[model samples]
Target: MAGSELPQEALWQRVAGRREGVLATLGPDGTPHLSNVYYLADPATRILRLSTTTGRAKGRNLLRDPRAALYVPGEDFFNYTVAEGRFEVAVASVTGEPAIDELHAVHAASGAAGDRPAFDRRMIRHRRMLVRAEITRLYGLVHPAA
Candidate 1:
C-alpha cells in the first residue's frame, strides 16, 4: 500500500493479533540477533511497544545498538508485514507503574481490550521501559508459492 494509504488501524490489528514476531538487533559480535517477543503496537502513533527483562540478550543488544527490526508473519511464511525501525530506549528508573498506560488507553479507546490478566501481571511485575521506534520502512511480502 502507498505510505499515505497504509491503513494504520489495519496494520495495528494485524500486529496485535499476532502472538510472536522476530525482533532483530545487533549482537555484540556485530552480527544480527533475533528473538521472539510479545508486543503492543499503537497505530495512531505508529509505535510498537515491547517489554523485556532488566537484562537480557535483546535488552543488552539494544543498549549496545538501538537499531532494530520487527517481523510479523502473515497467514503463511511467505506473506508478512516487516518493519525496519530504530528504537530510542527509555529504561524505567521506577518499577511497577504501568509502562504503556497511554498506549493501553489508546488500545482501549480503539475497542481493543488486550489480555487484561496478562497486562495486569506485567504492570505488577516488571519495570516498565519504553522503546519508541519510528517505522522507517514497512512492506508486505508474499512469496509465489503461497
Candidate 2:
C-alpha cells in the first residue's frame, strides 16, 4: 500500500472491525444518498459487503449508479476511515444460499441476535440483495493506535 493509503493492519483493525458504516451512493440527480449500513469486510480482498433490498433507496440508487463511498468511524472519537469504490449488487436469487448467510452476517455484525427465524423470513420476503464494494481508494485519519 502507498503511504497515503491505510495500512493492512489498520484496515482490518478499524474498517473491518466496525459493525456499521455510512454508505454514500449517487442519486439519479447525482447527489449523494447517505444511510447507515451494517457491513462485513474481507481484509484479504479489501472488499466490504452490506445487505439491502432493491426496494430500498440506497439499493435503487446503486442500481442506477455503482459509485459509492463507505465511512467507518473508529471506537474512539476523532478517527475514521473512508473507502471509495464501485458498488456491485447481487440479488439472493443469483447468489443462492450464501446470500442468506451473508445477510445474516450483516445482522450479526450489527449486534442483532433476536428472532433469527423471523429475520430470515423477512430477508427472503424482501428479496435481499448484497452490495459488494471493492476498495479502490482509502482516506481518513484513523491510525492503528487510535
Candidate 3:
C-alpha cells in the first residue's frame, strides 16, 4: 500500500494515544543519546511532557543541550510520527514542590492509577525532574492495512 501523511487530528491522536517513544538528546561527545521514555502529549499545544531523574543520561544531556528529537511509533511498523524541537528541563527537586508537582501533573494526565502521595515521595527520593518541549515541527506517514 502507498503511504501518505496522516491528517493533523489523526497524527495528534496517534501521538496522544501512546506513552512510549525514543527521545534523542545530544551528548557531550556530540552523539545522540537515545532513551526509551514515557511521554504525555498535549496535542492542542503541541507540548510534550516527560519525567526523569536528574542523573540519567537523557536527562543530563537534555539539561546540557535543549535541542532534541522524539520518535513515537504508530499502530504498526509502517506508521509513525516524529516531533523535533528544543526542550526545557525543569529544576530537579526533592521538596515535592514544583518539580514533583510537574511530575504529578504528568502522571495525572497519563491516567495511570497510583497513590499520589507515595508517587510524590518516590519522585523526591529519586531527584526527579520534568522535561518539556513545544514541538516546532511534526512529520510522519501513515499506511493503513488494505
Candidate 4:
C-alpha cells in the first residue's frame, strides 16, 4: 500500500480538529486492545497528549508498557492518518490550572460538551494522567476510488 507523508502542521491540524481517536495497547492476554480517547496534540514537539482517569486499563497498561499506537481517521473515512508512536507515561496526580484551562478552551471550541457543568464533572471525576506520545513513525493513507 502506497502512503503519503503528512507534514507536521497538517498532522497537528488534523488531530486537533478530530473529535475522537482510537488508542491501541497490548492486553493482559497479549491481544491488541483498543479504546476511544480525546486527545490534544502539540505539533511543535510532535507529542500527542492524552488525558484519562489514572486507574483505567489503558493507564495501567501504559504503566506496564509505554509502547502504543494512535489512529485518527479522516472524517470522510476514505482518508486517514495512522501514527505508530511511543511515550513515557507519567502519573499526573494533580491537574494543573493551566491544563484544565486549555482543556476548557479546546472543549468549548470543539463543541465537544453540551454544557459546562457536565464537562467539568467528567474532567473532575477522572484522575488525569498525561500520555505524551512521540511520533516515531507516521504515514497518511488515502483510499483511491474503485
Candidate 5:
C-alpha cells in the first residue's frame, strides 16, 4: 500500500465515480460489519452518502459506532481504494421532514427515479435512513497484487 500513492484528489475522484463499495462498520462486539452498498461521494465536502434500513446490521452498527470505512474497487483486481471515515446517521422521517428530503437527495444522487410521495411513503415504511460518512483518509493499492 506504500509505493506510488495516488494523490488525494485522485482518490476523491475515484470515489465520486465508483458506483458502489464495501462498507465496514463495527459490530456491538467490536467485530467488523461489512455490507456491499451503493454510494454517492461529495469530493468537495469529503462526504459519502448512502441509504439503508435501520434494521440492517450496517445501519445499526453505524448508529452505535460512527467509525467506518468504504472499500472501493477499481477497474480490475489490481486497483482499489479504502476510504476511512466517521458516520452521521439521519433517520427516516415519517412526515416528510428534512430527513426525507436528504434521503431523496441520496436516492437522486444514485440516479434512481420514482414518484415523490410514493418514495417518501416507502422510505418511512422501510425505516430507511441516510448514512453520511465524512471521509478522513484514503489508502489502498493502485497496482497489481502480484
Candidate 6:
C-alpha cells in the first residue's frame, strides 16, 4: 500500500526490462537481511525467479521462513515495484540440477554474464537453490500517471 495502484500491464513493462533488485529476508533471530540479486520476472505467471546458493543467507532465510520481498526499481529511481510473497525454495537435486534450470536459460537469454552451460556448472558446484516468489502483494508506481 505504499504507492498508488498501477495497471498490471504497465507494471509488467517496468519489470520485464533488465534491472537488478533488492531482496529482503528475515534472519533466524528475526533480523532483516538485504541483498542485491539479479532476477527474472514472469509477468504472465506473476512470479519472480532468483538463483542463489543454499548456503547464502537469503536462501537459508527462505528455507527457515518462506516470507520475503523483492523490490524492482524502474529506470526512474522513484518509479519502482515491490513484490512481496512467500518463497518456494528448491535445492539442487542429486544430479546437481536446480529445479528451475530454465531460470538459468531465462537469465542467459536476458544477457547474463556467461553462457548457459558455464552458468549451470557454477550453480551446481555452488549448491544453488532456485527460488520462486509467489507474489501476495505488489506495491509501487510502475507506470507514470495518466
Question: Per-residue alpha-carbon lDDT of model 6 for 90-144, expressed as tens digits?
Answer: 8765442547475574567557637656666666777878888777677777444
Name the lDDT of candidate 1.
0.66
lDDT of 5 by residue, 66-122 (tens): 888999999887788899877899888675688788778888876773678898988
lDDT of 6: 0.75
Q: Against the hidden reference, what TM-scores do the models get?
A: 0.67, 0.76, 0.84, 0.68, 0.88, 0.78
Please name the candidate that would achieve the greatest TM-score relative to the true structure: 5
Superposition error at 14 for model 5 (Å): 0.9
Clashing pairs in 4: none
lDDT of 3 by residue, 78-145 (tens): 88998887699886456557767778878777675267678877777777779988877778998868
The regions of model 2 sitting more than 4 angstroms off are 1-9, 75-77, 94-97, 110-121, 142-146
> Model 5 clash pairs?
none
When 4 and 6 are scored with lDDT, the better candidate is 6
lDDT by residue for model 4 (35-84), tens: 89877676567777766655888887887777788889885676777677
Clashing pairs in 1: none
Question: Can you give the lDDT of residue 66 in candidate 6?
Answer: 86
Give the whole-model CA lDDT for all candidates, comma-separated.
0.66, 0.77, 0.82, 0.68, 0.85, 0.75
Q: Rank the candidates by lDDT, best first.
A: 5, 3, 2, 6, 4, 1
Candidate 3 CA-lDDT value: 0.82
Over 4 Å off in model 3, which ranges? 94-96, 108-118
